[model samples]
Target chain A: MTQTKIDGRAKTREIKRKANLNLLERLYLPEIFKGLSITFRQIFKPKFTFEYPDVKWQPPASFRGRPVLVVDDETGVERCVACGLCARVCPALAIEVVADETELDKERYPKKFEINMLRCIYCGLCEEVCPEEAIVMSKEYELVFTSREEAIFGKDKLLTPASKLKDRLEFLRKMR
Target chain B: MESILIAILKAIIFILLFLTFSAVLTYVERRISAFIQDRLGPNRVGPFGLFQPIADVVKIIFKEEIIPANADRTLHTLAPIISLFVAYSVFAVLPIGEKLVIDGKEIKLVLADVNVGFLYILALSSLGVYGVTLSGWSSNNKYSLLGALRASAQMISYELSLGLSLVGVVLVSGSIQIDEIIRSQANVWNIFYQPVGFIIFLVSVFAETNRLPFDLPEAEPELVAGYHTEYSGMKFGAFYLAEYTNIITASLLVTAFFLGGWYFPFVDIYSGLNPNLSAILQVIVFFGKASLIIFLFMLVRWTLPRFRYDQLMRLGWQVLLPLALLNVLVTGLVKILL
Candidate 1:
């Protein structure tokens, strides 16, 4: 408390003194005219407003919007190895995975994969923990759901073609 | 009989014109303020948001009228009506143009050609205090009462300088009639002759209209919404309309008194032009000048920050009053000597 008090006093002493005004500046009318001219000029300056609904902003690859599962273009199948690491690492406990035996080369598949989007905090922890690089954040931020059940995104809604997620995957690789 | 009919017709037309002008003024003020602040204001309602005021009126009319349970109902209802009445009535004596000769009969371009137009305006504008005061008192809200008190005090203080400043014009013109005052400025504007008086009047007019730098009555930060805090729905709309109407009236008064109403400088009015054509041109010129003053009012509002209550009172009583008295004294002396 004593240290802070001394610092506060020093801070007060360090404050810059305001410049004294001359006779013309003290009159106020001239200064008002000066201010008015400034504002008048500002009226012709380019406005910074975005008509939101008419022109949607396209987020960059670095933007972490909503998480989705990536599907390989050649195989037409999700890249998930059903490792359950994402489910374990998710702080929100939003992800769920049920692994089962598969005939495919991966030898394991997710019988059930779902993400409760409402519970998602968009921390990208699931994406970071995934070994197979199955899940990544997409640029789909406008998430609206009428019911709680509808907010639980199943595999069908979570899957996105790899071509659409090229930017995020490339960005992740570069960052890594 | 026909003269009375014409007078009534003229009053109706002027009232409609004022109402429309006030609405458009709101849109213009919003758009200009937005531009100054680097934003696009209300552009969706119509072309360049021209119909925004119409939409606002519709929305306000349909809103739920909320009155405090402990409020005085009668006074609450009467308050806005009083405000609207005072605002509309003040425009009656303001002449827009010179006389027009139609069908061998000369018709004056004023709703009422009363000789004491100056005093009439002062008296009516003073009466506007009742609407604000009564509304504040009847609302039973602390903020509203404080706002009302500030309004009344401010008006009383500034009205002195306002009247005294205009006294210089009355001295020069030798009449309390507004049209006569305008006529006296045919040679040179009052702004040139009575520059000090014009400044005093201009400042007082800002205070009188409760505009910024003198808008303690409706200081949103201190008072919730000032005297109109408790008002809602079309009742609130009435106060809003009255406020803008006062702005228009003040602008017109400034233009007529200082800027030389209906007189285009360096353009001889009697220079071989048709009387009707000249009259129409004069009316257009008068409105154009008034519009410029109104634009100035809006610009000043956006430019200046509100003064502290103490600062406002000090400026009104100590500064403006003294200057106005000196202006009147000088004008009187000059008139007597010259």
Candidate 2:
């Protein structure tokens, strides 16, 4: 700490005063005119603007949007075994899952799973806590709902086929 | 009887043209500002939102006229009227063309041929301060009063420089009439000789008209819509319209004073055209010159940041006033020497 303070003091000593403006420059009027000239040129420069609504922005696969339940392709069933892990992990209390008995391979399946889009913080915590990789973040970000009822995304809204979520699954696999 | 008809025609033409121009400017200002910020502005109203101003007018007309319970209703109503009146009235003295000949009677392009037109313009613009001050005072809000004070202060400070700057033009041209000033510039434009005067006059008009870089009166962040805070509906629209109309008038004045109104260089070659055609061409040239200056006004608004209230005051009193006085002195000395 003592050596660092000495070095800092020596460095401060090397600092030089900035050059002052000449009398003409000090007048400020000419420099303002120069600044105006620059901005005038900017008006003709190529603008980077989108015709939004007509042309949508396509976010990358790595983009974390609304969390969705992954539907297994071969089995034709939601991979969420109604483990209730997502509900427990949701910081916003946005997720609600009710487990029911299933005859096929898994003993438990979610009879009712709901995620309140309004309450959802888009933290991806629910997606991360999924034990079976059942839920993952999907890039379908542009959400519009006038009513609260419409905003509460149920299984109909939440479920995405594993084929559609290949990129996110692969990314997760790579990370793991 | 024919001259009366001609005067009426001029009035109708002037009113219709300015209103349309002011309306078009609303759309243009939005589009230009949007481009500056790299965003696509209102393109949904009509094709490229060309009809946006019409929609805006409709909306403003339909909006409820709200008067604050504790506010001065009479003064509040009167303020916008006064502002609109002053704005429309100033165009009376401005000459846009040479003359129009129809049925053997030639009509002067200007609505009124007042001898002291320039002085009238200066006087009327000074009175415009009342409208802003009344609007602020009547609003019964602290912010409104503050905005009113700032606006009145700004107008008063700049009015001196605005009047002083034009004195050099008056001295050189040897006439206070707007028409005579333009007529005198036929040989050589006043801008060549009075460049400093033109600069001072130009900057002063920006402040006088309450344009950006000098728009502390309605500084969005500080004062919520300035003196017109409590105004609603058409009253608010009137003040907004008045501001834009003032811009056109200022541009016209600039064209008249320095740019040689309706007098383009080497125009004698084209003087052989049909007399009516020549007059029409001169009118076109005048408007063309005015439009260029108006474009500069809008460009400067987007380019420069607003001056601080103190800096604005300092500029009016310190820089522009001294420069304008010097220009007048030089012009006076040159007149005597020559």
Candidate 3:
């Protein structure tokens, strides 16, 4: 037969230990002085408060902002080349593209492209899957709009100047 | 008519002083608590946060007031006013310094030198419970009601011990007048004579003011916001102001009764000094005693863990009450024997 276990003694010992701890806390004289000393020290210390609006906190270095499709400034044409990679990789199914034949290059180009930013997860997956290096994530955090329809960016809102990145970096540095 | 006018002027000055002290106490409480915790407190508002209380006042005044629809409007409004008024009223008889003569006439620092000043303070302190109770009841919230009940019960229970503890002092002084008691304590001080009574009184005062280690009613983790749960803006500020004023008043009463008010030890050695200089020295001594008591009160507030509701009640009824009675009985017996 297996040896019978006796848990009662172990439990009793644990209870006894807890009881002693309680008694020690109650009887300790230095503990009282230590507690009082904390309040006394805090009395003359400066309060931590920041006046908002006039003094805004700079966002963390790695903070991700709104995603945007990049355009080549010299070419001044559609850089997407109807790759369909962004639409496939999008987790929220927010990006859509319609392919059509272009007159200049005779290559399939996007006739209708739309990104429902309200549904966009901003995970940078769209930028990751781009083969032509057309789309890149932007650092525009202040993305407020009056209406939901206005928030859904089409080809028009996605087409931002390439030099906008240099200006954004400087602005972020100045905020720091 | 002239006497009445002078009395009004004195009262106004006293109220202003009390208000100023109460406000400064807020700053002191935060700074002292911070220092004990090994951190710097509010020092940015003004030099060493001297104007922090004023800034707090402005913020509270400007904050949008929110009144709950279910709350009893009249009682909710009246509660804080009652608390502040009672707290302020206790200082009317509190002597900050002895009388002085500018040209010929003697002017007392105190607003009133009433014979029943001790009783007046006791009565007003008891009255402070009404504000907590009413605020809790009027809020139509369960937590508020519970907090109110705890506060009222704690105050009422401790008050018996508090009043009894002081009986030893009153008996020895043979007068209910605070001024008379202080004058009697000039030579020896009541602390030496009635040590047990003084301890009981100090404990009971902590309970009476609903301060830390005795602050069951406003236990933040358990009760959320406690008695003034629904109060907002200036209303909440009133309760805060009342609390600090009550603390200052408790300090003043302790100094006057136990530490020998306005009396410096071995001052007779300076007999050759001018009478005016002596009076100034006495005033300094009185304020010094008061400051020590205030600092001790703040220290104790941070040191002890708040008693559980049952423990608080047990201490008040079983421990302190019995001890106060015994102190009084022993004092009475000693007086008779001597």
Which residue segments of model 3 deviate by more than 4 Å?
A1-30, A38-176, B27-52, B55-77, B171-175, B184-189, B192-195, B233-236, B263-303, B329-338
Tens-digit lDDT track of model 2 for A1-176: 12223564463334455579898898877877887777677777776776777888887767898899999999889999999999999999999999999897888999999999999999988888888999999988899999999999999988889999998999988887
Model 1's DockQ score: 0.85
**Tens-digit per-residue lDDT, B1-338, candidate 1:** 99999988888889999999999988989989899899999899978788999999999999999999999999999999999999999999999887889899999999889999999999999999999999999999999999999999999999999999999988888888989999988888989988999999999999999998888989999998999999999999999999999999998999999999889986667457888898899888988998998888878988999999899999989999999999999999999999
Give lDDT: candidate 1, residue B180.
91
- Give the true-structure RMSD of model 2: 3.3
Report the number of clashing residue pairs per model: 0, 0, 29
TM-score of each predicted structure versus truth: 0.95, 0.93, 0.73
Clashes of 1: 0
Two-way DockQ contest, 1 vs 2, winner: 1
Model 1 chain B scores worst on lDDT over the 10 consecutive residues at B265-274
What is the Cα-based lDDT of residue A49 in candidate 3? 49
What lDDT does the true structure give each of the candidates?
Answer: 0.92, 0.88, 0.81
Native-vs-model 1 lDDT? 0.92
lDDT of 2 by residue, B1-338 (tens): 86677779889999998999899988888887777666667788989999999999999999998999999989999999999999999998888877777777777888898999999999999889899999999999998999899999999988888898899999999999888898899989999979988989899899988888898889889898888888889999999999999999999899999999888765653466766787888888888888888878877888789999889988988888888788889889999899
**Candidate that beats the other on TM-score, 1 or 3, i.e. the better one:** 1
Clashing pairs in 1: none
